[model samples]
Target: MTDQTVPRKPPRRARGEGTVYWDKRLERFVATRIVGYDDRGKEIRKRGSGKSRSAAMEALRLRVRDYERGLAPGADKTTVSDVVKDWILYGQGQVDDNTVKTREFNCAHIDAGIGDVLLRKLTTKHVEKLLRSMVATHSTRTIADVRACLNSAIKRAMARDLVDRNVVELVVTPRGTTGRKSKSLTERQALEVLTLTKAHWMYAYIVVSMLVGIRTEEMRALTWDRVDLDSEPATVAVWRSVRKSGDTKTRKSRRTLAMPDLAVDVLRRRRRDQDADRVKAGADWKDTGLVFTTTLGTALDSANVRRGFRSALGAVPSVNPAEWTPRELRHSFVSLMSAGGAAVEEIAHVVGHSDTSTTERIYRHELRPVIQTGATFMNRFAAVDVVAPDWHMEPLFRLPGEERTAHA
Candidate 1:
């Protein structure tokens, strides 16, 4: 074969010939040869791709590096574990609590399981096996969750060059069951809850939550400038959501949410209460600018809000319907609004959902029965002659303990 390597005094060498020529460009040993090139119409020579000319010449001299390594010249072999750690650091500091929870679940359950393995050695079999083993203890749906987590984690690993191939591409993940729709209060039940809440210390706070359907975090982070009671339509700008850390989670979540009429009225009363509170804390109260706050004027926590909501809930006999959560009140509000002939799109906009589809998907179960009376009225009307045609007039109808009844 023609020597395509750098030109030198001695050019011809066998495959295993241990000969090296000093590279004039870099003054280092390199396997050199002169070969004719069509591009320049003359003999050309250049150093081969390697760590250095010396290493390239050594590989040619030994003939061991002739075969492709199937890898690039410079690549780090980071373990999956190291890559996962970097991912966690890059993700957590800026995301909301909900996002943090999702990523944490992926890292702990999926990433940790295969993190120590070499990224290049990861294969489709490993992914399938991990999914299968997870299926034994978890339901098919939960196993699919694991699969999604693995796919996400591997995606990050691949972009960072930690893995040669992401095995998630070859595996087919099972579709999983979804989250349930929340339980909502009926119209009468909602009225009773509203009436009972008026007597509580946190009555206004409770009203703001139920009527507005603002998330608990968003409600707690409300501020004075964010509320415009004098505006023609009025509005409550939900610019921030409180976190367990007692801080706003993200800048985007701090949106200006407008208020409905009922919400506006409730907030008006709440502002009056806040004015009185500010007077009492006078010198002691730091002007936190927070619209909803504790007696001391600091921002409120979700636990405290739920604790207050629960106490008021106990007074409402109708709230005894079934198992309930504070978050479900948002569902109750949306359901009440929909049942009142409000369109899904209207509710979607009022609730600050990205779109109608999101509102429909997230709150489908909460939609109250519009035609519930149909079944109840029919059952009542039909009960007297419910069964067979003309059989009501038949003498075959029997009373309790009768021979006919016993035989039937």
Candidate 2:
């Protein structure tokens, strides 16, 4: 009865220096210890809360190690830019410009915003503030992509020993949990943009972009042989892309696409037109056979595409209210395909997407249950609309009626 009156503490066993057990309203087996002792013997206490006595003892041991290493539980410090740069340089040759450009930009944003801060110094409050600041200046997708890059950078940094651990990984991204998709243009808006594009002195490239869903730079590397104009179901062989490097965008970009009749007709006209231009120039047009090219027949510049796109948008009367860039035209094309009830897989393939899920996510608003038709609509009868009937190639510098066809 005398022993029962007292609490059955673990007999105050000393597993290590300054470690003991204390009983309270909770379990009696909790191991409490002074992790940092001083000359007066007053120090920080780490209390373990495990049901198992051995587990409590283990916690006591871990807390001592953590004190020795100068950290409390769950304290970490790593910066967003620090992680991004480590991964970017780590993956020197792995990703292309399209990938690296966004990553670099995101890294720059992080460096500008909070790169100097320690990882442990980053708080949820700091992240929210930085995110709000970026949102104020950039589009939702751009900000989201930047966040993703930072998160991935931290993950890779951890792998490379650049960081003790990734605190960025623990923090939720500003956009991922928000569930927002990039803005897709309406069909009418797209048509208006397309009409403006046709009149803006870049018809050949614009025609290909709308009809075939080829990216702007991919338009630069297209050649005559890769396009099959005579086939019943004509096709565009996307063999490469024009990159910032004066060459194709990616080795994986050389995929074949089943062209719609509209796109096929557009390509045929452009090819015929370009061929005539070459004959007139005699030797100026390089014999590269690029479907869309500069006057010198070299890879087209990205800036030129942007300028032309901007000019086209400015030309439209009704489109004044709708703010969109040239790249939005790509989204417009995808949106139209989705609206047409095309199968998710079909749109994914035609658009050179890796998976159907990507198509569904981007064009999620356009999905319907007519059955996953997969690219079968590409074989549908040609509904090619002629933008210019009886159109012939005009000499670049010659007046309209004075323009003469140069035979190659």
Clashes of each: 3, 4
Best by lDDT: 1
Q: Candidate 1 — which residues are off by over 4 angstroms?
A: 1-77, 132-149, 175-181, 243-261, 320-322, 368-408
Estimate the overall C-alpha local distance difference test score of candidate 1: 0.67
Query: Model 1 clash pairs?
Result: 237-257, 238-257, 239-254
**Predicted candidate 1 versus true structure: per-residue lDDT over 164-255, tens digit per residue:** 56777789865334434467888898888888778676777767777888877777777888889998778777766666554444443345
Which stretches in model 2 have alpha-carbon errors above 4 Å? 1-101, 119-129, 132-139, 175-201, 243-255, 280-284, 310-317, 365-408
lDDT for each candidate structure: 0.67, 0.65
Model 2 whole-model lDDT (C-alpha atoms): 0.65
Candidate 1 weakest lDDT stretch, 10 residues: 66-75
TM-score of candidate 1 relative to the true fold: 0.64
